[model samples]
Target: MTAIQPALDGTIPTTSSYAEWVDDVRPAFVTAARSGRRFTTYEIAKEHELPEPPNPRADWGNFAQSLVRDGLIEHVDFERSSRPTGERSAVSVWRGTPAARAGRVA
Candidate 1:
C-alpha cells in the first residue's frame, strides 16, 4: 500500500520582513538626505548591500513607499532633461525627516 500524505495548509510569507533590511539602509539614506541630496531606490539598495532576488518586484520601491507612508521620508519631484536635445521628464527626490536631520547634525 502507498503511504498517505498530509493535507497542505495555506499560509503566506511576508515581504515586510525586509523592514530590518530597510532599517539597515535607513542610516545611509538619512545621511544623504540630510545633506540635501536625493537618493533613488536603486542607490539606497546598493548602498545598503541588499541582495536582490532573481525576480524583481519593487522590493526597494515598496520600502520607499512604506517610508513615505509612515512619514519617515518625503518625496520630491523634479524634471530631468533628455540627453543632447529633447524634452524633460519628472524625476523623484527623497528627503529625510527632522529626526534624521537632527541625527546628522549630532
Candidate 2:
C-alpha cells in the first residue's frame, strides 16, 4: 500500500499494474539501498533486471520518491543516467539512510 503511494506528497497515484510492479520490485530496491552504495534508479533496475512499470517515465520517479518519503533512502547526488532512453539526462543518486543500513527499514 505504501509502495503504491505517489511521488511527491501523493499528488500522483501509482495504482493498478504499476503499483503491483512497484510492490514486487521494492525488496530489491531496499536491498540495494541497504548496501550503502550510491546508485541511480537506472542502475538498480539494470542490476536486478527489473521489468519496467506501466509508465516508465513517471513510475520510477514515483517509486524513488516514495522511498525517500519512507526514510529508507536519501538523495546524495546526481549523475547522468546509463539507460539509453535516458539520453544522458541527470538522474538522482541515492544511498540508504542509517536506519536502512541498520536493517531497521522494510
Candidate 3:
C-alpha cells in the first residue's frame, strides 16, 4: 500500500459520512484529474487519505455513483492489458466536466 496523505492543509475531521469525506477530498481529486492522469478509486482513496472501506468493491461502487449523481466527476475507460481469460476490467478514471473545467457551474 502507498503512503496516503490528505490534500487539504487543515486537519481531517473525524466524520464518518461518505459525503463529508468526498467534500474533504474533492480538491485532491480535481488536482489529480487536472494533471491529465487517470486513476482508480483505490488510488483516489489512498491519495486523499480516506478510510479504507470495509468492503472495497461496494464502497467504490457507491462513491462512483455518488460522484456521477453529483456531476462532480465522470469515468473514462481504456484498454490497459490483455489476458488469456479474455476478460477486461475497468479502472475508474476521474474527469471534471466542461463547466467544471471552465470553473463554471455544471
Candidate 4:
C-alpha cells in the first residue's frame, strides 16, 4: 500500500456522522477506484447505491478527499454532474491509483 496523502487543508470535519458516512461507502468506493475507470462522485454513488451524506455539499467533497488521501483514487478531471440535486454543476472525475489496482489500501 502507498502512504496515504494528507488531507487537503485538513478542513474536513471529523464528526461521528462524517466518519460513519465515509465508513458506510468506503468499500464500494475502493472497489470502484480499483476498477481503473474515470467517474464522477455522483456516478459512483448512484452506481453503487451509496447512501447520501449528512451534508451533501460538504461531506461528499470531504469523502472524495479522504479517498484521495488514502491513495485509492485521484482527481482526473471535471464534468457536469448528472445527479438531480447537482443542477448540472461541474463535478470532479476520478480514477484508481496504481496501488489501488494492485489491491493495496491504506
Candidate 5:
C-alpha cells in the first residue's frame, strides 16, 4: 500500500485571490494602454509574488488569458528581464484593449 505520491513542490502559486488578482491586474492593464507603461507577464507574476507548483497558482496566466480572450487586454510589447534563475528572459507586455476602455474600470 506504500505508493510514491509525486515529489511535492507544494508551493502556493499566487499572492492574491482570483478577484483580487483581477483587481490588482486591471489597473496595470489600463495604465499600459493609457500611458504606455509597458510590463511583462513575469513582472506581473513576480509583483504578485506567485510561488511555484503544487499548491495552486493564485491566478497564474489564467486571469491575463481571460482578459486577452475577452478583448480586455492585448499584447503591446515584450521585455527581457531578470527571472528567478538570474537569467534575462523575454516576456510579453500587455495593454488594455479598446473593449476594456468602454468606460468600464475592469
Candidate 6:
C-alpha cells in the first residue's frame, strides 16, 4: 500500500451508519491483499453487482472509505475500468496495508 495516510483521524464518524459496510468489506480486502493480489474499487463494486439507484456507489464507496480510514488499504495505481453504469473511467487500484501483503490474513 502507498504511504498516503491522510490523517484518517476524523474521516469516519462513529455514528455514520456505515459500520456494517466496513464490517463486511474489510475482511475481503484483507484477504485479497494477503494473497498478494491488488484490486480497484471498481472491480469489487462490480463483483458485488450493486446498484446505483439508492446511491452512486451504494455501500461500496462507504466500505472502501472505511477501509482506507482504518489503515487497511491504500491506493496503489490507476487503471481504466467499467463502472456499474456501463461507463469507462480511470479508477484507483488499492492494496492491503504492508502487514497484509504477506498473503496470509484472516
Q: Number of the top candidate by TM-score?
A: 2
lDDT of 4 by residue, 2-95 (tens): 2123357632323248777777678777888788889888787666656667787788888889888889999889888887774888889999
Cα-based TM-score, every candidate: 0.50, 0.81, 0.54, 0.78, 0.50, 0.58
As a TM-score, model 6 comes out at: 0.58
lDDT tens string, model 3, 2-55?
Answer: 234444864333436666555555566566555556666656655566654445
- Flag the better candidate by lDDT, 1 or 2: 2
Q: Of 1 and 3, which scores higher on lDDT?
A: 3
Which window of 10 residues has the lowest lDDT sum in candidate 1? 1-10
Pairs with backbone N, CA or C atoms under 3 Å apart (clashes), candidate 2: none
**Per-residue lDDT for 1-106 in model 1, tens only?**
1112223542212224565445445556556656666666555545544444223466656767776765567787654633223554444667776655665331
Query: Which candidate, 3 or 6, has the higher TM-score?
Result: 6
The 10-residue segment of model 3 with minimum total lDDT is: 78-87
Worst 10-residue stretch by lDDT in candidate 6? Answer: 1-10
Rank order by lDDT, top first?
2, 4, 6, 3, 5, 1
Please give, for residues 28-102, the per-residue lDDT of candidate 5 as tens digits.
Answer: 555544543456666654554443322334344676687677676788777776566676767667866765656
User: Clashes in model 6: which pairs?
Assistant: 34-103
Deviation of model 5 at 97, angstroms: 0.8
Off by over 4 Å in 1: 1-20, 53-55, 78-91, 104-106
Worst 10 residues of 5 by lDDT: 1-10
- Cα lDDT for residue 56, candidate 4: 77
- Segments of candidate 2 deviating more than 4 angstroms: 1-16
By TM-score, the better pick of 5 and 6 is 6
- For each candidate, how many residue pairs have backbone atoms clashing (under 3 Å)? 0, 0, 0, 0, 1, 1
In model 2, what is the error at residue 80, expressed in angstroms?
1.2
The per-model lDDT (C-alpha) reads: 0.54, 0.81, 0.57, 0.76, 0.56, 0.57
Question: lDDT tens digits, residues 5-98, model 6?
Answer: 2235522222234554455445556766665668886565445432222233556666667677766677788887765456677877888877
